[model samples]
Target chain A: MTKYLAVVSSKAEITALEEFAEQKLAKDDAIVLLSHPYAYGEQARLPGSVLKTSFDYLNREELVEIEGERFRLVPNWYKFDKEFEKSILYKGIQLGELPFGEVDVFFRENLRFLRGLSNAIRKENPDVVLTGKNSVAGSSVRAVAEKQQVKIIRYFELGKQRTFPLFPNLTTRKVSESKKKLSRILSELGRAKRGSKKTVFIASRGYLGNLEQELREKTGFNVFPLELFLLRQSINPLVAVKPFLNKKKLQGLFADAFNKYKQSTGFRENMVFDGVFIGDLFEFKLQQFALLNFPEFVSLVDRIDALFQKKKPCLLVVWSDFVPFEKICVLTAKKYRVPSIAIQHGIFPAPIYKKAGFIRAFAPLTADKTAVWGRAFKKILVDNGVEPGRIVVTGSPKLDSIYNRHFEPEKFKQQLGIGNKKLVVCATQPASSTNNPYQMVEQVLNVVERFPECFLVVKPHPVERTEKYEQLVQRANCNALVLQKTDLHALLNAASAVIIHSSTVGFEAILLERPVIILVRNQKRSGHTGKPRLF
Target chain B: MSSCLASVLQGKKLNELKKEMRKFSLERNICGDGKATERVIKFIENTAKKTGKIELKTK
Candidate 1:
């Protein structure tokens, strides 16, 4: 039996891929290793038997020890130690044993943990190592695979495609140069070996339901849903905690408590306990941390270096939204003689801040092949400096579901207890310094009052002040429902019409075959009332 | 910054803007030309071929 090692960044992605892998390969023979940035203890375990790797109690200590031999500990160990101490000490209890403060100790500890992972892979001596796209653990696996002379495969979940227009002010010259540089780099990486049984992983949910089998039939590359990753984390004991403590002090305290608890419980080194903690924190904050980690940067550089050293060609396919990371990937691809193809995540239009002139003019020229959602966005790319030849129109996969949806309005209305009445879905926009939701509510109420038979569904933007909406709903004294969940397809399907002020939901409503009215009331210009512009 | 200001100042009429936007609407053409997935796959394949690798079987 061919030995294969699958390293995953998150348990969610792991669980998602496990089902697909099980269908393709025997469960017993294939080994799956899950690496989380923080340890989640028993909570990280999968349903089936699988090996796990994570940061241990003395992760910093282990990293420090291994730093000199392998891996440069950027920002130094002292900074990490200070951060660790600060993270733990300020979290809850004012006084606890001060954790080891030496930067070298921390670096050695982390290095040891990484080595342990590499050693495990070496022992298994797997022919192929697979990981999710763009994660710390994924990057580490790539590094280990390179060192061990093992093949590396990455999985990515593609999302909806939309065409965005370019603001006219930005020029095409700058955009073309950037795209050319990226293209040049990707071309240098070379290509996969011909006739080799290439292991392919997809992270798209769209492919999971209806497209999986179709994709499999079409591509012959393994088509796995992103749900596998979700499953791993869902079953993990660490995933249950609600970590969104509003107070920073409380959050720190919880981290300290977690560390102490892990130590007492005899938690192993390099387990992703931090992930569990961070997962419980705000989603935005977690994303911010992931962006700052620089794992993607290191991994791209390392891969390019290896490719160059071996005189082998490689091609990297990446989503464009990871632009900052794309820069690193592009530069590394260039250095290592690799070719990269940037698939569009959504429509790229003229930069919103195009009023900033030259800054906007130079931004879109970064990708080799700029795959857009439609001709409009394509033109925007061309106007922004992308070579028209390099731009491809690949409609968004997310819209596939939208296009095929067939909703019975009466059935949905009955389910939601909405009687025979005209339904108006009032999708809220994000509240800005100049945009007041309260005033908009007043205007909407005024309109609703005129039509008693009409029911209003006031779905406020997730980040907006909920209390304000509640207060407005009360003030309006009209029958209303506020949508909390992100998916509003069902409600949209059942609506008679939709009202919003500069929201993407309006576009979604239009897709649902509903009339959309934009209501703009800028606080800066209170007296002005005009038909709002639809983008 | 001044250049950005100048462009905004040179704004087109609403009707003209709508005319420009007509090309993006569904009436003009289905954005994907009705074979988006296939197009994407082909692009990937061509890219792979250029890099000297056989296209991975999509199915």
Candidate 2:
């Protein structure tokens, strides 16, 4: 019998793969590797007996050996390359001098996912690996399949037609010289104006509410975009040479870790979820990633140093110190004795057992000062070990526009076409760093359908696509308007009650004095007793 | 999860919800009262003055 392994990460993938298996792989023995099973919610209906590749398998407390050192797997995955970092020195600056520590948090999850998939593939030993076309997961599959020497087929939907395309033959297009020149011209034009006005560098990825404009109008400080400054600076390859040459040290470190990993029975057995061990899977790729990014990091160091020396800014206002660029700016600002403030972007969650490390990323405020929304946030930060004196309860500058402007609730309701009905705004955020909003959106939709009196308005997170939620709304046949780009404050004004899944908008709803139902996934954290309580 | 939502939707526990949210907000001292922008501007002004980055343009 022919053996097949179907790698499905979402509901759409599972559905397409099932249809394909029924038509083509009906006679063949197939097993399904499901990740984010909550996305689609049906695993039993998949083509074969399902083997979950979801993070559900991760034992967060499990210990693993890397280079003869036993370390906790989940929290310290980024530290696997710690030794490599120690050996590198760029332009008389150490690796730790740059804001590179928290960057690994972004990649750690992907490494774990890739490691899990590699283990599953080795265990299954399928003839062909079938998966749906996903930019993030597909790259991982391509890499794993290429290494395993297995044939891989990707299921793609072009309009209505379902096409199964084979991998390993695609080639990339080169950037034209003229296009590069145009980009450089554009970058030069977009560079922030450096003038006599004392500047306050606003470190942001767009979306800073009214703070940017308000700062420009109300304050003497010129509001400069931190990102624009980074982009405007030309990269110097000479600064990167030291780290590039020291790439050998990284390879040696990974070799030591992998060799030690293979021999450790405790790690091989306990650190594994299914056959996947939370060990070094992408040793070569990670080394390359570090080597490539080190140059950029070194360049950023020089550029930030230039910013401090040239601009002589009074203060640096940033979104968060967790972001690499912002972190670098803040650290550099501190060296120059310039004060930096990190404005809280969202409502901080109360302490949770599993989310301790993740929550700590927000607390103890990375900048010289932290401006929070209220006393509640200050309390949370203080509880999380941040010095209270450094935190200023600045309220939310983003919400200032909402308070200042007038929003007609009836007009917003009319726009939504939910006439005279009580509007219940369901605000959603792309929960988790993995961007798993599907399951949360599905859960909200299911609950909203039961209440006929309430007219549901689904406001997706700014980063999320509206079409996906619209598709979900269409499939459910529910009477809910999925507004991707709408004034959330207006919607909150129209809402009789707000339903939220740990989104900052829920806090806004509270500020507007609208009743809020916080839909927390953790039953214990939701403070559930016999009686129903809105937490 | 849906159970609490059901209670809120049914209008059976809205007062309870509002009360809980109010208590939560009060304890945390949430809400900027529309003065957040003014405060942030003031902070910037004070910082600039303290640092003597630029001479104040007195109106």
Candidate 3:
């Protein structure tokens, strides 16, 4: 049997990825030696036949005496606050102290831990050691494996291949500008050594809105929304596309697509009502646009020249899925010796079409270090050839609030004003180039209508066309609730079952233990079943 | 100056290098190794004694 060591910093990431990996490894004879930063004395029983190290280490008395086949206690090393402790008590996982200290001290401690783990590996000598890329645990595993000459496999769940390049380039530009600004400021500082003021700027995209204030307080840097850069660049879609495309092909295709799309304004106008149809096309077009607009190439060289004018170094932090930008960032970072960190924006699952020639050929290289939402994404990075040492599985701070959430079905039903009915959450996917979402939704609705005692909660994909769905639901005249701004987790907790067509929310619903039915009709040739379907 | 392991490791020396050539290789961040630390310290002490040097002493 293949023995594997999986380490995750957060419970949620561990929970999601453990289940996913277990399912994949079930067919093969394997035992997973699981380690987490938090104690897993409660909420254990992950998928597949696996041994949890933390669980084994725990004394019998420490195990939560929970009754049920599904319940098991696994040890983890996370220290929780009072409120979190209460929640952990409810869930059954014991909380442990998180090792926190000065960065150098933390790293030395981490290295010491690795030495022991390496010895453990030597004793057990597992065929493979699996971990997230760049995570502390993951890095520790890699370091140990390197010392011991063991095979290490890394995986990343959120494989946004294209976005990796764009960040480096953007950071290079930012660093160049910062260097110029810093030189002038430093020169002024030199002239007036006393009473000179210095300011550091920190900027992030709206995606990192949750961290804006925290980052500001920690670093005493001016925090600005990443949209500021978009606005600064005028959201030049072309600026994003040019790095990947052949110049002539990009220009010709862009002109043709733009003109064709413009002439078909009537069809395009209807897209607001049919988001699926237009969203997929729009995504493809944007990808094309990125290829054509190679302006960043010339600009990057000019920026490199400017960097030579100033002597100070700058740090660039990027988090996004725009691939060309990431490539540029990587190249510039390497060229200028600037430190660059890429934060994983969301759970990035690999494109399902692993066998596709184009996708395989065009896959972009990842960042120096990637911050992942969970172990699921970290695993995805490892699977894609990223070294485990470069991945950080920081639990999605955004979903940290959701980790402790528990909902009562009765109370949820009362709030939604649906009485004594099984709730079905229907999340729609936008139409892709090869799939028609309207037909899929209509088909699923047909199945849903058969169950009169069921209420369907429709959460449309952001880019989905809603008018048709609204009309279809009205025509069926069933107990249907259409929500635009309601929290998905709340709705998911309230649901008895979920129906989706290729949206990622389906997987989230499954993680929440809701039965999900995937509507498969008119899907793209890309081998991805979109989101996993649960029956 | 490269050891056999260094030659096989590619890139730079494992201790000096921060990045990996490939993204999917395994890396770890281990903690809570009092036992292993002691073992390593012992090993170094023995090696230092054998070599007639006091390099293993803690600062």
Candidate 4:
């Protein structure tokens, strides 16, 4: 009578679980696969056997059903807000009191999934837990399983057959063996086109239209986008021939990287900003994540190094120093004596957390130059021990996109089905600041409710999972526009009033000259309808 | 965020902090036009020339 708690964080794992549900395991071998209830409801194919109940029991008052689905509702602002405060405020005595940014914010989001998983683990009391591939959900499940003293079986797909390991780690043998085989098909090493132009390697998708054009014109450098952006995407078709690279050299580099992991002291030894006790905890977690990811990191660095060796690029420009790929690329570029530059991708790392010591904010270590939004942003780096000379103000290349393009408010209003109504744009972060996602959405809804003539336009953060918000909209049946993959700057420009928690979007609203309101946990606005002030 | 950040997020009583940010932007307005990118290019080219290692095109 084996009880199994299975979790699906991958599409492959989802298909595998669906197949498993069809099979009759030995008697009393009941399985419960816990996932985000709303995640599977409309999008994924999930069976009732997965989880009998849902965490969404929110609205008893004025329930609105959408497409035959009723959303449980609650006022979530305070609860979610408190949860956020707890996760970030643990930084230190002085800096801990202030709000967190970037890496700390990611941990706060992971804490939500961790909470859900911990509850599921305790209630089900399963003998074992199963999940797939590397993701925030997978990491959260692993953390919970370790605390619960439960065994976790991880399955990774390899072409047709799958490798199921009780304690799964992405090891060198599994990685190298695949690349060695890839060398058979891809036999030629990728050659860089050596033009009279100085080459500069870029690691992020060129999202901004004019920035690259301007850089090439001013710098006289051939802007080369990195070949592999992630697991599958190719930034350049030519870089795809990297698989044909000398397998022996890649294997050798990976072996060295693995050895370094075994001998190396964790980030704890290197990082000075994080204060005592929790710093120790962060080091252990981040070190583990880094080690588990070492082989892949080594492979990427080696691949990029191959390009650097051939092309002899003068500069390497990456999105940020935080991401593992970008980190490796920066280090690799340094090894080749190529100056690496990190452009501000999102909000300039907020001043509050950078000075306080957010862990992954390690761009200063490798980047010769760190481009920022303005002098205030430069101060964030300099105050945190980054060299004053290294920080450069680039304003945001992303914002320059807004300056170049324009959207008609009338067209947007018609497209959104809110004809001639004043649009109160309520922007959301990709991750919730609080435990409850709906509470934040509902708070904005409550504001929109005030103006019967004005409908709410919910703009999602770029990195957000909008399913939770989508579910809330369906259940509440609010007259809100959830704009995904739309021109956000135009909407903000056209907005009557803008509402946001502390985020880069809020700053953008201010830059756009829109009336702004900064929502927080405990606050008193004696009168709700006064003119909006700059946040 | 510095101590003044608390004041800014509060949205009011942070006039000094806002002024500081505004002043910072004005002083560092090299981001205007193509000045920031020009600085980056000039810096990279000068370093390359100083090294006398790489032949860079600085048109």
Q: Give the poorly placed runs of model 4, Cα more than 4 Å off.
A: A1-195, A206-209, A217-219, A227-292, A349-365, A401-407, A415-417, A431-438, A523-535, B1-59
lDDT of 1 by residue, A339-399 (tens): 5556544322223323221112123444456555666666656655567888777765445
lDDT measured at residue B1 in model 1 versus the true structure, 0 to 100 = 20
For model 4, the DockQ equals 0.11
lDDT of each: 0.45, 0.60, 0.43, 0.51
Classify candidate 4 by CAPRI docking class: incorrect
Error of 1 at A216 (Å): 4.4
Q: Model 4: which residue pairs collide?
A: A58-A72, A58-A73, A59-A72, A59-A73, A80-A434, A80-A435, A351-B1, A352-B1
Compute each candidate's TM-score over C-alphas.
0.43, 0.67, 0.40, 0.56
Q: What is candidate 2's CAPRI-style docking category based on DockQ? A: acceptable
Tell me the lDDT of model 1 at A318.
48
Off by over 4 Å in 3: A1-209, A217-221, A229-318, A323-338, A345-363, A373-376, A405-421, A431-435, A463-468, A520-535, B1-59
TM-score of candidate 2 versus the correct structure, residues matched by position: 0.67
Model 1 CAPRI quality: incorrect
Report the number of the highest-TM-score candidate: 2
Error of 3 at B6 (Å): 62
Candidate 1 has a TM-score of 0.43
lDDT tens digits, residue span A316-398, model 2 = 88878765567778777766778888888876563442233334346546688888888777777777768888888888788
lDDT of 3 by residue, B1-59 (tens): 11322232232343322222112112222111212222222322232234321121211
